[model samples]
Target chain A: SAVISQKPSRDICQRGTSLTIQCQVDSQVTMMFWYRQQPGQSLTLIATANQGSEATYESGFVIDKFPISRPNLTFSTLTVSNMSPEDSSIYLCSVGTGGPNYGYTFGSGTRLTVV
Target chain B: AQSVTQPDIHITVSEGASLELRCNYSYGATPYLFWYVQSPGQGLQLLLKYFSGDTLVQGIKGFEAEFKRSQSSFNLRKPSVHWSDAAEYFCAVGAAKLIFGTGTRLQVFP
Candidate 1:
């Protein structure tokens, strides 16, 4: 499993501000996933980041609101743009080892709070 | 479409008691099942996973899960509970895109 280091474990911002969360992996991986876990809710996939290409966003998620950048195999960043109270959630980054037998590793997660 | 269901929202157990958390999933094709535990202020940790093999699988921290294909269930179990085992448990299905169930929060008491 890959180890991920996520920055800004938590943060509080104004309603109109934006916050960018970062994840750096200790090993190079083919794919990196971003997820949002709303309070008292199950985790939801936001987007999938692959090196050298634009991210693939989930149906409910838009690149405009949740832009993802994968500059390289070991680094990725997710930005929550034009934040609102409703956008408050815990964001997580993960990397899978490529099969059902191997599980994925997740970052500690960033707890975002919008005022 | 793939989905996961965790029937229990919260479970309480005494420190030496046995524990079981139920999870059911719906997916087409060969399903990949996983159980993850998340402690407060920490990241999600993989407890166990089932891809292909025997139904019974053992995981770290004395946790085990049995995969029942006919029932589409992968329930987690432990012979004895510990206060440190208190956390949120999530059941997910998929290899590339994971569909997670609403987690079950375990409350362990001495």
Candidate 2:
């Protein structure tokens, strides 16, 4: 399986501050994804990080608020801009190995708490 | 859009007993279904997945799931439960992005 490592495992930030979470993969491949898990809730797809192209956000998520940057195949970053209390959740990064060969693997996740 | 549903929110079973977790999906076309397990304060791990062919699929940790297209269901089952099997299990369906169920919390007693 793909191994993904994410930065800032947990953070507590002020309401007006912002946080940028980084995810790095061990191997180069396509189809990187960002997901958010709200309090006691299921994981929701935030966006798909396509290398050398803009990310495709989900229905409810927007690009401006959650700016995603996929510099290359092995790295991607998700920035939570102007965070609020409602933004407090666990942000996860997943890496896929093309088709169903290896499936998707998630990082330890960043637990963000906005006050 | 693809959606997944897990009927049970919580399940308690004793060690050496059989275990089952039910999941249903809604998609017009054939969809990829997956079951993931998460331990306390840990990331989610893929327990098993059903993509195409072979209705019965075996996965890690002595787990298996059957995909029934007619029933729109993919249920996880194990013949014998281990105390270490206690965790939250999530069922998902997708292609680009996954639609996940609320997850089923399992508790095992000795």
TM-score of each: 0.97, 0.96
Q: Provide the RMSD of all predictions against the true structure, rounded to 1 decimal.
A: 1.2, 1.2
Residue B1, model 1: Cα distance from true site in angstroms? 2.2
Error of 1 at A7 (Å): 0.8
By summed lDDT, the worst window of 10 consecutive residues in model 1 chain B runs over B40-49
How well does candidate 2 score on lDDT at residue A90?
A: 96
Candidate 2 deviant stretches above 4 angstroms: A99-102
TM-score of 1: 0.97
Runs in model 1 lying further than 4 Å from the true structure: A99-101
lDDT of 1 by residue, A1-115 (tens): 7889998899999998999999999988887999999998889999999899999999999999999999999999999999999999999999977643366889999999999
Model 2: CAPRI class: high
True-vs-predicted CA distance for residue B93, candidate 1, Å:
0.5
Cα lDDT tens digits, model 2, A61-82, are 9998999999998999999999
Model 1, C-alpha of A50: deviation from truth (Å): 1.7
